[model samples]
Target: MSVRDPNPLDSRHPKRVAIVLSSPAISTTTGWPVGFWWSELTHPWLAFRERGYEVVLYSPAGGRCEADSLSDPRDPSRYSDTDLISLGFLSTPKLAALVEATRPVSELSVDGFDAIVVAGGQAPMFTFEKATELQRLFVAFFEAGKVAAALCHGVALLRYARLSSGEALVKGRTVTGFANIEEDFADQAVWEMGALTRGTHLMPWRIEDEMRALGANYVQAGLWRDFAVRDGNLITGQQNFSGAATARLVIEALGG
Candidate 1:
């Protein structure tokens, strides 16, 4: 439950991190509002802060960013109603302000940061892969031997992010993301709720399918279980629930 117990020296020298979120976008498949997942951001932010690391929020483009409706703790759908962590984050004026107005990735670089973590939601399926600057920053952190992590659909960056050597960053690495089986359930839930057709999909492509295509040693756990995979400086989480677990891997990799 610890957020930050600041070290006196932190002001002079802090371990800075860039936590990236997908920009606000209308989902092509669902035609619904989407951005980042609330828990995916709040949980990992808490984890990193607990270590006194300064976590800066960023988006593909600067300005206010939205959260997928279902991820909102106050949403009428009640999908994330039990997420007190997000509820607390949203209630706090200072913490909530972080996501409301994010700095654009294009305005920053990998220069001063020691790590980067990408949190995902419906928007990443439509935004992350094509945001060259975001991918570049993620890859640059890895190439510099710094911790680079992503959770849920955010892991999609690994599919398209390439090293300076001109090869996929995920190649030969063990990883996990939003799985195909979970995607099936998400589609089914929407169908039962009458928001989508029986055979329609909420995602244009499956994260599992693409990660497998990249020949990474992809693995996952039971539905909604907190699972994370760490391969060197690269860390990945299976879903939104895996945020803190994945951040711990990043902390370990940083020798915390």
Candidate 2:
């Protein structure tokens, strides 16, 4: 009798997921204190925890993860009022502990996880682009046929993720993320005093532009819609609102 090896891509095993957060911690183009968004991080976390998947949080440079000021309940902006998932997450001491001791991606091996999710924030545009390590990690996962997901500004990585063949990871995949029009509207909003600052224009090229440039299938649902797309094993969400749905898509793709 011959013993066969287990197929790692098979979703029967308990999934070990690693989620990457921002480190340089600055807004995309505005220079504001950057961190993960409330719903973007918590909703997906809740979805994963509910499915009994083990979750690990990592930052590019490692350290405590910060929540964007706009997402803070104590902030007057109240930008995330409709996000109940974040509200509950912020209220829980145990759940709050994750941000306090998040491991740096430098200390972990992406290959050990079944899948990896790159969570977003206003800061991802700044931190993610320069994160060569993260780019490499994502490419490795993509080549290995593992599930890879990103939301909002986190999708910026697709611009830099090159495959072993020197092709972009999103070259032919359909995906979505924070839209340029939303950025324009956000900049015009009270968040900024109409200075047309750097962080205010960080998104630069919309997901549609960059994805289309690479010949990748790109779509934008709306300004702030809960839209997510799954291309093969790769999953992507439009914005913060799509976090939960994106996570569910990830689980479903894994055959849960």
Clashes of 2: 3
Expressed as tens digits, the lDDT of each residue in 36-78 for candidate 1 is 9999999988888888888898898988989988999899989
RMSD in Å for all candidates: 3.4, 5.3
TM-score for each of the candidates: 0.94, 0.88
Poorest stretch of ten by lDDT in candidate 1: 3-12
Cα lDDT of all candidates, in order? Answer: 0.88, 0.80
Residues 167-196, candidate 2, lDDT per residue (tens digit)? 888987899988777777776764466656
lDDT of 2: 0.80
